[model samples]
Target: MLGVKKIGWSVLLSLFVLVACSANEKEQSVSQNDGGLQVTFTTPKKVEAGKKTEYTVHVSRNGNPVADAEVIVHLEMADMDHGLNGFRGKMTESGVYKGQAVLPMGGDWIAYVKVKRGSEKVTKRFEFKAEGGMMSPEELEKSGLHENGSLKNPDF
Candidate 1:
């Protein structure tokens, strides 16, 4: 009788573990879909207007590179005319994506990234300061953009 009781308990334990594992797998898949594509910006976290900055975006899934994904970046500045926007280029031979932008004003600018993977979508936003001021190339390197600040371009 003891032997039968042990076997029954063992079988019940195994069944519980199997059910828990199945549920965990489903939950993980759902979370991954919610996270969408991850995004990162390579340029200086803060910048001055009119200074060219380089940006890069990386797309991946399950810790492996996800090729052919689309990444959209937008820069919204209160002082600038219209905002800046661009799409991440296709993966180069090196296997990463890149984009570029020049901020046009000195106020706070918001960098927004929207990543789309098949039916899933992910969005992220980052804020940075674009200084406004006028100076020689040397001064510009040390300080920020001209004093006029952003143009507040309505087209944005």
Candidate 2:
């Protein structure tokens, strides 16, 4: 009886871990509707800091794609300020816009997407987390730290 109970508990714990990991691997997508316009944003399941990640946005009005619109995405750290990190998205297909942006650090982030067409405009926000990765060249320079992870100003 004791052996059976241990086996049952082990199986349950294994299942729980599997479920959690699978959930984390699923893509993160968000949809919003504002002023008769619907926007869907899709991102990868895992985003690494300091690496360029492609972001996709789909915009539609009354079930029809909004093709001739300007799309801009601004990435900001939710817990801290890292300056303005903005990029313009180009239309890859009807109503689909794609762009790339490098996350500055590993932490919670918010992406503010703005779409403009003629006199109409729409904006949406999506929040996500980025995993830690190697620092980019620009980030290294701004931090005044050497690539070897040493401080340039040793006196300080």
lDDT, candidates in the order shown: 0.51, 0.72
Tens-place lDDT per residue, model 2, 7-120, is: 465346445544554578877788899767798888888776666689899999888999979888877767555556756888999999998766655656788999888988
Least lDDT summed over 10 consecutive residues: which range in candidate 2? 147-156
Q: Which ten residues in a row have the lowest lDDT in candidate 1?
A: 25-34
Which residue pairs does candidate 2 place in steric collision?
A: none
Q: Give the per-residue lDDT of model 1 (tens digit) for 37-73.
A: 5555444544445666666666666566777767677
Task: Report clash pairs, candidate 1.
Answer: 79-150, 79-152, 80-152, 80-153, 81-153, 82-156, 133-145, 133-146
TM-score list, all predictions: 0.52, 0.71
Clashes of 1: 8
Clashes of 2: 0
Error of 1 at 90 (Å): 4.3
